[model samples]
Target: MKEFLCTDKDFKDIAALVYNACGIVLGEHKREMVYSRLARRVREHRLKNFSEYLAYLNSNKDKEFDAFINAITTNLTSFFREPHHFEFLKHTIVPQLLNSNKVAKRVRVWSAGCSTGEEPYSLAITLADLFPSSWDVKILATDLDSNVLAKAQAGIYTAANVNGLEDKTLKKWFLKSKDGHTYKIKPKLNKNIFFKRLNLLQDWPMQGQFDLILCRNVVIYFDKETKDTLFKRYANALNNSGYLFLGHSESMGKEHSEFKNLGKTMYQKQHNARTV
Candidate 1:
């Protein structure tokens, strides 16, 4: 038996709160996971059961809610987790941007749902390698979880976190700790990235359009309706012919005519599609 009682009603209530708060759908299979994560919150508050915890959360939402969301968010990421995306960015996207953005020489990339900073950092490294120092290049990395955002902002990772990185790449972009237990991203590589906490379901305050948006593996937990809405939003956020990268498992449907599928879960914004 569990330490705290999590009845069906309690699980349902928690699920409802999570969905309403952040668009993540907690199905029946997620009940045990939810209980295991939230049970710690209950213990932290010295609550007797999940029921009391929920009531406390509702009453002190401003304080406890961030903790609640952070506990449940999954932040599994690594440097260059999807190599093909980076390869495509280097080969195809860079060449096009060079031709089209000759006057501006400005490139903007967004790593939505950038957990613990790997995706955006990878993007930064890639851009730093290709783009001239004179060009204005920037990356905006955003996530809903504050804890992970802090970790990402610090740019520190253990040896295990950077296991698969090549020796040359590691030496170029990271500073090894004296004890050799961890590595920190070098300032040159981290300079172009700006991290922020953002909920995708809420309003985005960014005024300029992005040249590429990587929202990989993020929409899998969302329902179809949410996914559709997010895809449209991504379309609007992107510049004409701007790219959007999804996870290997996620794909846009035919109804989303704003984006043209380029295979490998890559998409380019259609030049003549109506934006929402």
Candidate 2:
């Protein structure tokens, strides 16, 4: 009715809405960010106001809540992100795996919140480089957003996707499209990687027990309680000496006893031999 600008109440109301819908907590300082992100929903819905849209979200019997969450959760990632983590995966983790014939034979890596494919593709390339001829590499990349998963499965990306790659690496791993602007990972590179649509809120499909899990920058949007629950579940899913990689900002902290830090944001399964 009146000219609308998002207010504190609007921000709190949205925070509550998002939390209920997806377990994300929009904290106090995020008032402006909440406003900025939801403003588009207002314009798109052409509602009378923020209050009206909020009401609509509340009353709808069944809506595409995943799409709503995907709309808000920022999906920013790149190939070989936090390169040191991959380095650790290669040099430190894989060396231990090599010693144990049981764990070394087959490697299972889960890119928990793989955005548009770069992260998992990066893992595949790293595996190709680090453990070539190791046909036992099985990589699973997942995202809650079906839209992003679709793009991830296709493995084709615009020029912007190659953000931090060297020309030599790009030339080695990607094939420029006939049009010359787009590129895709060569099919040979796709062997180890599989992309699937998954939501962290839902029960994980596979009986995990994975060698490594990469849930980087994913749960930053989730509330603390949700984070604890997810991380505990993650711990359970890992093998006795498996590893977990969180975003530089997302730390396991003292909350979970199942893991110990391995420098940087990297963590090791409690049973693993200590790193110097």
Candidate with maximal lDDT = 1
**Collision count of model 1:** 0
- lDDT (10s digit) by residue, model 1, range 72-95: 988898899889999999999999
lDDT of 1: 0.93
Number of the top-ranking candidate, with TM-score as the measure = 1
Off by over 4 Å in 2: 1-10, 59-64, 101-104, 132-134, 272-276
Clashing pairs in 1: none
What TM-score do all the candidates reach, one by one? 0.99, 0.86
Q: What is the C-alpha lDDT of each candidate?
A: 0.93, 0.79
Worst 10-residue lDDT window for candidate 2 reads 60-69
Q: For residue 207, what is the lDDT in candidate 1?
A: 99
